[model samples]
Each structure stands twice: as structure tokens, then as C-alpha cells.
Target: MLEALGLSTVNESVYRAMLTHPALDVAGLAAHLDLDPAQVHAALDVLADLALVRLDDTDGTARAVRPQTGLAALLAKVEADIAVRQQQIEAVRAAIADIAVTHEQHEVVLRLEGIDAVRDRLAELARTATTECLSFSPGGAQPADTLHAEAPLNAAALDRGVRIRNVYQDSFRNDPATLAHARRMATLGSESRTVPTLPMRLIIVDRSIALTPIDPREPRLGALELRSPGLVAGLLALFDQVWQQGSPFGEVPGARAGELTPQERALLQLFADGHTDESAARQLGISARSVQRLMNALTERLQASSRFQAGVEASRRGWI
Candidate 1:
């Protein structure tokens, strides 16, 4: 009944038994619930992780925490996670506002109708970019066709000393083709990193010309090319901030003990912010089934019996 709160059926049953049969020992609770001793111990481990139950230091008996106390702390952490998405929204809104004002002035923004046109423009900019090229590549993995077409352009840019820097989604780590491409790009002097999410798919050349999709959520529609200094600068700053938070390409992030990958941590934050599996999957660019798979893996890795326990332990470890 309390499963929505991250509790499993066994966990809820165990917790309720503990509250009602306050004097019951481990064996007693197991007998009362018709569960084996092993199952009872497992549930207690999860309960302890959630701070829903504590081991009495002197007597070594398990005691249930009042729901008001334990659940409130979890709720407070959930509230704090609200800022993550808020920051992203405000950044995108500011960029849109800057683009709107410049777009009205005429001659600052150009509409590109198709992928071919966008590529032609990119080729032009790539050839002329004298200082540096910056881009935010969203979506999980690069399409094979797109990457094939882009490789030569990147090579040409590198050959001329136009520094190439890119920010890709953290999910790219799970794709072998993408990781291999990143490695090849790195050897050719490309500087790239991965962040959990990016506000838009953007490309800025020499910090002067910027190309951003008209609608980030549906980039296949088309894009807007902007040359206004104000608009470009805002987009550049956004890249800089996201880049600062990114893990450099080729590095294994959050591989250490008690840590979560940036993407994994971002998923947890969204879950805390009240997103369902489907909603979190949408934000994380994965299937809802994948979200469940990830949480199950996390639960096992943390030696937890339930998602609630894993999440709580992650918080205690400062992972979220």
C-alpha cells in the first residue's frame, strides 16, 4: 500500500509489523508475517537504511521511527531537488528572450529550413571559424549517418587549428560507437565532455555565429542561425556553465565507491522532484523500463532491498 513511497510490499509489511508488534523480536516478526528469517533480516536492512528503523545501541533490538519524523526528512530533500529543473528552465527562457529581441531587429537571425541547409551553413562556418568552435550535442547517441558526415568537417576544423569543443549527454558513455568516436576526436585535438542534460542543441563558431534548433524538443523541424553578439554571448555562457559541470570525455565518472554517475544522480533528483518512471525516462532520454532496470541495479549495488533504501543511503552518502 505504501509502495509509491519507494517501499516494496515486504518492506511495508515489515514496517507495519514492527510498529504494531513493538515488543516482537526478529524471529517473532518473521513468524507473525509468515516470512522466513532471511526475508525479515533483509527487510530490516532496508528499513535501517531508510531511517525508518534503528537498532537500539544497547539492547540491539530494532525499533521503528515515527513516520512523521522519518518521512519528513525525505520530503525536505525532495523539496531541495526542485532547483535543478528550475535552473535549466530559467536558462532556456533567458536564451529565448534574447533571441526574440534580436530576431525582431532583422538581419541578426536567419531561418534554416532543412538538415542539408544546416550542414551547408555549418561547412561554411567551419571553414571560416578562426578561433574556436563550440557545440552542445543532445540526444543519447549520434546517428551513424550524421557522425559520418560530421567527421570530415571536424577533421578539417582541427587541421586548421580551430579548436573543437563539444558537450554531449552523459548517456553517450553507454554507447560504444559514440565513445569510440569521442576517443578518435580527442586524439585529433577535440575537447569534449559530458553533462547530464543540455538546454538546447547548439553550435557556436568563433563565439560569433550560433545555430540553435527552433524547438529543442523537436530539432528535426529546423533551426535558427543567430549572429547577434548578445544572443551568442548568452548561449556561450550557458555552454561554459554546463561545461564546468561536465566530466571530460574518456574519463570514467562516478566510478568510485559510494558515488553515482552524473546521469544517475540526475535521475534520482528528478525522481525526488516527484517524477514517475515514465516522466523520469522522458527527462533522462531512456525508456521507462530502463529506468526501472537502473533503479534495480542501484538497489543491489547499495546492498539495499528496495529503491527507498537505496535512495536514502545515496542521500546519506551525499550522492544526490
Candidate 2:
């Protein structure tokens, strides 16, 4: 153990013996250590140089050896050094916490307004993800900019081995854009599914972060980004719950082209005719809630948002 303090083997042994026999003549020290007289003297000389031991001349013939009292002070200093190092470590941890807070603000998390902002955010999400992208778009609440514009980013993400799992509404079965988008995603090895209308839109990237809109009527008008793992996980749970009930993309139940429902045709035509939710609901003799519900189901099925987008998607798929 004394060797750890940079003591030579002989010096360490001599010092240990000196501690036990605080004062001893060279002959007695050599005999007790089982070392030669010359070697015991040599070890004492080295220990003296290290301030661990010293000569004593209590008797007239100068035949005594003793340990220095300063060893106690050295041990005390070691304890003080450990305490100082522990305090320094705690200070570093506090500084890191401050830096993390500053970094969160510097990263600029905020609401993005309008179609342009929505488009940009989606592109940003696609570019930033490392492992996978999860999208739970209920009833096709996704904007037009997202529907047509994300193809390139999706393709790029696919090339980089990023998996994309998108859940849509069952009404998307008749949407041309939904079909085309699903086809493109499939070609890139991304997975898509359709379910009955879900109430909210959820987008998650890399399992570390997520974004969700506050209101379905104006999704771009307000949204929140969450970095907290617990919150993101909660949102993911809601998404998975809905996803479990969804059908795989491009899976139509019936055998033929006329297998589409009248509600699907009406929703498609009304959307193509440029009717807003209030206007469409008025023409259909239904409440706006019913229209919103239909919109949700349609977008999920068609993977669309507004009726106008659904119309364009329908034209592309020859469903019109």
C-alpha cells in the first residue's frame, strides 16, 4: 500500500517497520525486517529523502531511527483534495444544466402559421429524423402542401434508411392522392395504414421529439412541439391505439370499380366543387360536425385534408 505513494520496495518496508517500532537502532531494525544491515541503512536513507522517516540520536552513540510527524498532515491533505474534487464535479453538473436550458431556447420552438409554415415544418421533420418518422393524421387533416410536396423528402428519408409509418382514415380508400401517396411510400418501403376517423394529428420524429396541432379546424394556426419523453410517449400511445384498428394502405374490400360508396362520391364532388365545411354541410343537410367527421374519415381514407385536395387526389386516381 505504501508503494502506491511512490515509495521503493525497500523504502516502503523500512517505513512500515519504522511506524511499528517508532525508535530503533539500525541493528534492531535490520533484525526485525530480516534484511541486511547495509540494505536497512540504504532503505532508511531513501525514506528520509521522502520525509517519511528520520534519524534519531537520543542515545550518545547515535543509534536511533524515527518516523516524521508530518505523515498525519499528508493524510489530512489527501482528504481535503478529495472533498475539493467532489465540489468541482458538482459545479460542473450545475453548469451543464444551465447550458441545457439555454440550448432549448436557442433551438427556437414556436408555432408556424399558414400552408408555407406547415410545408416547411414537415420537410424539416423528414430531414431531421434518424431512425423513423411516425405520423397519425386523423381524417386527412394534413394540408395540401404536405400531400403533394413531401414526396421528395420522403424519398430522401427512405434512401437514408429512415422508416416512415403513416396512419390515415378509412375514407382514404377512395382518395386518388392517398392511393398515389401510398404507392410512392410503398415503393420506398415506407408503411401506410387507414383507420376510422381519429380526433387528432400527431407527428413524431426519431422517438425523441413530437409535434401536435391544438385545433383540427386550423391545424397550422396553433401547434406544440414536445421534447419531454413522457409526453411524446403518451402521444405515441394514443397513435398506436388508433393505428391498431387501421387497415393496410391500398387494401380495398370489394372486387370492382363501382365498389365505392355514395358518401365517398358526394364528399369527393363537394370537395372538387370548392365547398368549405360550412357550405358543404349546408348543402348536404347535415351538421358541420357531421361534415367535419366525414372530412376526417375522408382524409384518413384519402389521406387528405380539405375537399379541394381530395378532388385533386380523386382526379389523379381516375375516381371522378
Model 2, range 1-320, lDDT digits (tens) per residue? 65544467776776777677756666888898898987876565445434555334353222213434546544565678789999999997995565466447754244556656766877888887789888876553344556778888988999999989998765555456766777878988989877545557778888877777746666767566667667678888887886776667767523255334544555556655546678666454455787778666765666653333444455667776
* Candidate of highest TM-score: 1
Per-candidate TM-scores read: 0.68, 0.46
Candidate 1 segments exceeding 4 Å error: 1-101
RMSD of 1: 5.9
For lDDT, the strongest prediction is 1
Candidate 2: which stretches are off by over 4 Å?
1-109, 140-143, 253-320
Candidate 1 structure quality by residue, lDDT tens digits, 233-312: 99989989999999988786666656777878888887666577898876766678988898888889888755555766
Candidate 1 weakest lDDT stretch, 10 residues: 72-81
Error of 2 at 163 (Å): 0.8
lDDT of each: 0.81, 0.66
